[model samples]
Target: MIKVENLSYSFPQKDLYNSISFTLEEGEHCAFIGRNGSGKSTLIDIIMDPEKYIFEGKVEKESNCRIGYVSQFSQLDKIEETTVFQYIGEKFITLQNEIASICSEMETSSDIEPLLEKYQEALDAFAAINGDDFEKNINKNLNLANLNKCKDLRISELSGGEFKLIQVIKEMLNSPDLMIMDEPDVFLDFENLNSLKNLINSHKGTMLVITHNRYLLNHCFNKILHLENMELQEFEGSYIEYNFSLLQTKIEMQELAIADNEELERNEKLIEKLRDRATTDAEGARGKTLRVRVKIHERLEKRRIKAPFIDIKHPNFRFFIDNKIEETVALKVSDYSVSFDELLLENVNFEIKSNEKVAIIGPNGTGKTTLLREIFENNNPSIEINEAMEVAYLSQLQGETLKESNTIMEEFLEAGLKTYEDVTDYISDYGFEEDALNQKIGSLSGGEKNILQIAKVTASQGNFLLLDEPTSHLDTYSQIALEKALEEYKGAILMISHDFYTVVNCMDSVLIIEDKTIRKTNIKKFKKMIYASHFDKGYLETEQKKKLVETRIEKALKEADFITAKELSEELEELIKLL
Candidate 1:
């Protein structure tokens, strides 16, 4: 349990939080959400350790509480040199060392009273932290996540997502009373994100997470702490509930502002007219009118309400298909298989027709990215692209492709689509300000980089788009903006994304990559399949068989085969599991 009061914090150049106050109770899960540079991260940092930050705030905590923190980028140079097991083991190293010292002291010292007391204290501390079950807990979680393979591998060999997972797992093993996770959704694929979500939701302690992943916010959090206009607002519900409440608040505030403005204007005009008449009137009547005007002015000043802060700015993403572009299938892949040291995908067949939007959804390391790369990079005979279809690709690895030396303006100019003036207007639509144009690409934050990447690809004005996780690292506003743009795009879209919202809204069809094969289906159908699959193979298989039985039963009835219909009905009953 933690409570922050009158939390006023300021950086060297700007004030971020002004009298922001909130309390996170035991076992409460809160999502801290705000736009970029809104001090969500700074608040988390202050909570983690108030001493580290120069601020006027009272951070009250339950005594003897252990806090576990997982940063957005949990980087450690030493992680590269250590094996995964060793890295994870280091989390409990201090406890282990303390216990070891206690044991050593007990064995060597003859001082019975002090030695026994110290030994008992150390043991109690170890047991209180769940030290005895640490390894078992680690292995169980790792196995559940299908990350057991990383146990023996060095941390350096792990992928970006894997490293983040390990860091989170290590913290969870610490058994802290409170967990503060900053952007835990970063770099994670769909399956891994789900796994992480399950892990976090199962945590019995309190949580304060700063993330932009809607899935996490909707599923994991019970409360929403929105940092806006340099204030912390506590909403006692999920993100969806918070959003509805915010919309209603805005509506109410706007109505009030309108009424208040009308009243103020009327009062001012009446006062002015009274003054003009008073100048030509007798002294007694003039004094009375003057008193009435002062009273009216005082009332108006007391009741005047400031207008609500409603930010309407968002990244502008407009994608257009050239009229001269071909109207045929933009991409076709048939009997295609990709391999590295081992075969990642096999016999994949799909086609994206002009103006069609398709999404590829799969578990992490299932070669969704690999397949996309192979489709675009490899010159296989089985894969065909329409000659008239100019391709634009948005790779997930934007940090690698974007040049650090180039300024924001220079980067857009390098795309060669528009002049300096044109580029400024183009990037600003994506939340880049006039001042940001001169900022080097290297200095951009992850979200800024994501927007820049999107800007560049959209600027290309190609007829076909291949986006790999374009929604990752994007805030909700930016994601919605990009989604709207993609929805309006006339070009064909083939995206590999883990964000289910993006899939449901942007894609008409889905390419599900699993077991080295690809299955194409509509978005709604795929959802049913995935839901059934979560139960196990038996449930999904039974559901499929039930559908078949129903079809047979319908056909038998249609043909007036009463005996066959009865038999199929019995089969259907057996296959149907209680929903």
Candidate 2:
């Protein structure tokens, strides 16, 4: 639907691109992707003709084809004064104006034949863009984006995530022939992101999305536009193909360098032989020439430094932390609820037992962390907690239980842990090196700090653990290593995390805080609820729908995998009876 020919752009110091070109087919969903500093955003801006970016390219399209572009950066001021409802209505008004403009032009024309043709063409274009659903789609997608719930909420009051989603819904309603997005999944999680994928798949138009999340790339993209060396190339494969190509190219370059080094080595040996023959035998002038040749060979050798080949493949890691739990209740709350002024959660009941590794999962601002903090305060109404119980907390920002000037080793020692062999063993066990031990806790990576905190937990005498987004900043390897350690933990565990891999591995049961209620369900049952709820949402339908439904059925087919199989059965029975 959109084509760019001989696209070129550059800066004063560098040529960003030269003769880059691509074609977006009528229904192709293309992912415009590259590394962080690869000028992906600049290309989108160039295509959209936003501002005065220097470029030399000719973008041609089907005549009068409407294009809707949603960039990553939100323009708050552009729509802040408009209410969500009014903004939704504006989509219809814009289409109506286009229709009226065509009608008005037809009335002003003298030639009946040409004017009638022009009016018909304009009307066809309008219909082609599905102008009829402009308002219906606006309201439907707006509600999906939660703009309906925030009707009274001003644009200024919207959160960063809410604002991003709002604009996406607005752009979708425009029904452009082509939609362009950059970092479209920036603030979205698994559920909302799946919603976007469904939207893209259902739309008949073309799309070009630029994003950094590999998960999104793997799930949604059919083809990839890999940018390298100021050129454009069409590769017919998923994101995995691009990653493999990048790896192969790097390996090939390293091998070529090695071959070049061997050639230089052979030349140096020849020079040495020539020098020895001239000096020891006859030909005095030849000796001088050979000496000069040797010097040249030395300079050449100096220019080509032999570097050890490094193969660095960052493997994605997913950790499993679940170990069998002891059959004893570690904590319990009956009819639990907390209210700050007006917000109240009542009739909440849940239990955690020894040896059980559990997590409280929910969306942001859903008060998952608040529930954890309340436990430390003896479920107190207003009193804040500080060292209320023998628990360790890792907040979302990882801004808890750490201090400046405190070495990892010192912190471990201070935790009242068992005797250690200079703290290196403990740190290394969690995947940190000896060098990282002496470093102040302030500058450590999130993973490094997480490892240290895990070490602290092992060293301390605390039997019950309280963690908030404990795995938030950890890389896959560190997460898995910690998970392995938790598998053998003698005490109970409680965490609030959105890391799907980690949670799936470690959690025996789930404590879900959704829609202002707390519910306890075994991991298998919770997984069923997620799928059923998704199907209930209307995104997963047809074959995908059948697959999700079948998977849930198979899970139900299995006997209880956890200790609460009987309890879950009774819960299901009660739910069925109510229905």
Candidate 3:
């Protein structure tokens, strides 16, 4: 259990909080939600007591019990001078060494049977601590991370997602009474994502989740603590309650603080006048003062003093283009072969056109990623000669490609951005904080790396964009932001993601990838289509209920049978609707 009474915090230069109060009861799960730079991590730092933040008022925590913390870093860094496995395995070494030490201390005891019993007890405790299981679980966590047989690998060699999995495994091994995870879902592949959900769901003690993954928050958490205006407000309901409540609060703040149309226009005009100055001594000092005054006015116009109401909704927008599909050949594939050992794609044939947003999907290791890379890598991305086309792709494994030496700011600057403000504004749209911009590429979290990769595609403004599992580690708000950016993009796009919410948002057509071929569909369909294609080696075999007039399968069978399958599927759909 943790308790905070009349607690307050702030920065040296700015007031982040003013006398906030909250208690995190034992077995309580809470979510801390806020926009960029609203002090979410600062609150986590206060909880961790990282020696950087100062806290006022009574704060009590259960000492003696181990506290497991997974901070906001996309991945865990291997600062320890140890191998990757050893670094993860080092967590229980202290307990192991203690057991060995206790045995040595007891070896000199007088009573023989009692000493033997004590020795056995130490052994049991040592066994229960799982020193050996630590090594195995380390491998298991890496496998879940999609890293192939990475046991002897160095932690320094792994990327952000790979490193984070190591730290998460170590935290799981500790099995502390209270687990504090700040955005643990960042950079995890699907298996690890599920593992994290199970980890949170199956835990018996307190879980303080400071995350943006609404799916996990909605499914597992019992309470929500929103960090806004430097205060943590508790919500006693589901994650849905917090989500709606948080959005509503922002809208209320907007209403309360931001001026109406006429006043905003007047302020804008005054600010605009400051930009255009007379090149004369007459306007010198007064113009400088006017510019300073305009900046203060802008900040004043944006800041809200009143406590925001938790019952409002804000407008949502997504990038969209009016497109018509007149051709069946949106995309053409001939002799498309990609592989890792076995053939992934060979003599594959598929066509894509305007009417559908096809999800390029396949299980991990099924060459879904390989095929997508080939599709994008092809020189003929467009059909018309001398016609320009834009194509963009966000690879799920894009984090693996980051250069260790470059800072985030350098990447943005290299991507054709001319100004710091422009770079910050665009990166901020993907839920990246300003502090994150300076983080070395190697130190960024898996989620941050994914955000950066997506940011690159969004920044690139390509016409035919490809995204690979863009929602794997993203928070809900970040997911929505990507949805909006993709919706407004004008050009052709090919996306690969497993997040159903995102699939529904950006997909104009569904392109289900199975066995190196693509099955395309339109958006107007059932949710059942989302995961139906994952089935192995069997179509949903159907037979007509009524007496069949010469079964199409028995008669024409090859071409007609495939066509019959389509028509029969449509008929079956109609029948289900009628029922």
Candidate of highest lDDT: 1
Give the per-residue lDDT digits (tens) of candidate 1, residues 1-579.
Answer: 788999898866457888988998888889988765567877887787788988886989888879999988758685697988888777467778877887787787778688778778877877877888888888987876669988999887776777888888888877889988989887687778877887887788888888889878867888988876687778888775565455434445555666778887887888787788788673778768877877977877787655323444567788866543546888899998877667878888888898789998876666777777766774878889888787888888886558989998888887884687898777777777786688888866677788888887877778888899898778787788888889888888899887877787678899888798998899889766665644454654565575577677657655656667666655654554331
Ranking by lDDT: 1, 2, 3
Predicted structure 1, TM vs. truth: 0.79
Question: Which parts of model 1 have CA positions greater than 4 angstroms off?
Answer: 9-15, 49-52, 56-65, 74-87, 97-124, 139-163, 261-312, 322-326, 374-382, 417-424, 531-579
lDDT, each prediction? 0.78, 0.62, 0.61
**Candidate 2 C-alpha lDDT tens digits along 243-358:** 44543344444545666678778877887788677867545877777777778777766665432212321212222223333467767777666666545466677777766789
TM-score versus the correct structure, for each prediction: 0.79, 0.53, 0.60
- Cα error, residue 276 of model 1, in Å, equals 8.2
Candidate 2: C-alpha lDDT: 0.62
How many residue pairs clash in model 1? 4
- What's the C-alpha lDDT at position 405 in model 1? 92
In model 2, the Cα lDDT at residue 17 comes to: 79
The stretch of ten residues in a row with the least summed lDDT in candidate 3 is 538-547
Of 1 and 2, the candidate ranking higher by lDDT: 1
How far is 4's C-alpha from truth in model 1 (Å)? 3.3
